[model samples]
Target: MTPTHPKASLLTRLARLVRMGSHIAHGFFILAVRYPHLANAERAVITRAWARKMLSIFGVEVRISGDNPGFYPPNTLLVANHVSWLDIIALSSGTVSRFVAKKEISDWPIVGTMAKNGGTLFIDRSNRRDASRINGQLADALSQGGCMSVFPEGTTSDGFGLLPFKASLFESALLAKSRVQPVAIRYLDAHGQQTGTLSYVGDHSFGLILKRLLSMKKLVVELHYGQSLQAGEGELASRFAISNAARREILAGLNLSDDTPDTARQTLACPQAVTQ
Candidate 1:
């Protein structure tokens, strides 16, 4: 927000904080008291509702295009590029799917507790055993026809191209004979240009992210869904191939160069926004 004067800037910041605080109270009440009593399907509905409100509170807007969720297979594994914590909210607002997040997020402030309530699947990356365990759990989840979304990049970058996908998660999809859906998330500024202001990266504290988010005039997020990937009878594709295909589809949606360097993808100054 380009305030004409110092006082205007300060007032704008204060007003934003007030709005943010109000939304925090409402969201916290839902998470702490309301979310627990809801059934699994109900929880997804509420989570999606809260996600939309969360973005509204932060002065963010979302535009969706391409394949619809209804067209997705009943047993689907969603793969997408990771950019910021806002990616979770943006995706959840659109899909009734559970997320695969890093286990450390379970220890974050209120968000961790909320994520748990939202049915997030936490994977302990540092523990080699955790991967195997989560894969099994994912297979079971898919077998039950649950929608699971994952960031195969294993980490977030400034909004741009994608990181190489870790192929292990694709193994779970293969085991369950589930369809894989590639999703793309992009953050744009007011002029419809890609912007790093919405990115959460580097060592910046979450507090700093909150400040940046509140101070922003607006944030525009775009989501694109690609065609589903399934294993054909008599066609055996390796997990690596599936992962590469998913990553390629996401890169295409984001309009990024294929096999681009991380440095080339994120050419902006690191102004972290939301999460890891």
Candidate 2:
């Protein structure tokens, strides 16, 4: 299901062009802020407007199922699986939440710049000390009524399944007493093949994946927002319970066969431990 070489190159070129345009749009916003009259909500409106424009320029199609924009409360933590970089753009356009991205993304050329400008929280997962520090920062952000989007899977998959949810990241939610909402995203080709090879897993480079996406005639992404789960009595128990519930909801939405590698299947089957 991987894209052909020629198509991949085209998608990359298109991605570069889109990035250039988004930068220009962002610069305009910065300049607009010189006038002291814009309030915080007004400024946010402008940024979101630009984000919508950027997505259109990049040719990413987004579809939503369950819960409109106002359905969930503010300052909630959105948990979802990782598939492509587009997941960030897609989710951001649909919700007013900052991203919790890996540290490597902060250094990723144009993509990194855009993510930082959009107020992404970059975490250095390789260092436990740094991770602990970021956890405090995340708590502060949530306390201030800011919403954050996180991918519990820790890595991207081939768009055919869900990965295990890392329970550690749920710590901030516990600290802030924030509710967790599970979101599921699926990328489909024109012919409706689930795994048309747009995944950026294994040795596949971002450049190659971007190229394939741009050359696509019609790309459709389905986003499903599952019911929100509140932090319960215990941190470990709540993390496990919410993670498993979110996992099942996502799997059901994608219509994916529950059959997979033994480990993945077992992880999905076990209910997350709950606190009293």
lDDT of 2 at 197: 57
Give per-residue lDDT, candidate 1, residue 44: 70
The candidate maximizing lDDT is 1
Those runs of model 2 whose alpha carbons end farther than 4 Å from true positions after fitting are: 4-40, 69-73, 107-113, 233-237, 257-259, 262-276
Candidate 1 at residue 100, lDDT? Answer: 77
lDDT of 2 by residue, 1-276 (tens): 455322335656566587856666665556344324654355456555555666666555778887554422466878776777667667766765677766776676665675666567877766766656666787788778777777777667776777766776677777888877788888776666565356656666666665566666666778888776776645325666767776776777777545643123222111111111
Model 2 clash pairs are 11-210, 11-211, 12-211, 240-272
Model 1 weakest lDDT span, ten residues long: 267-276
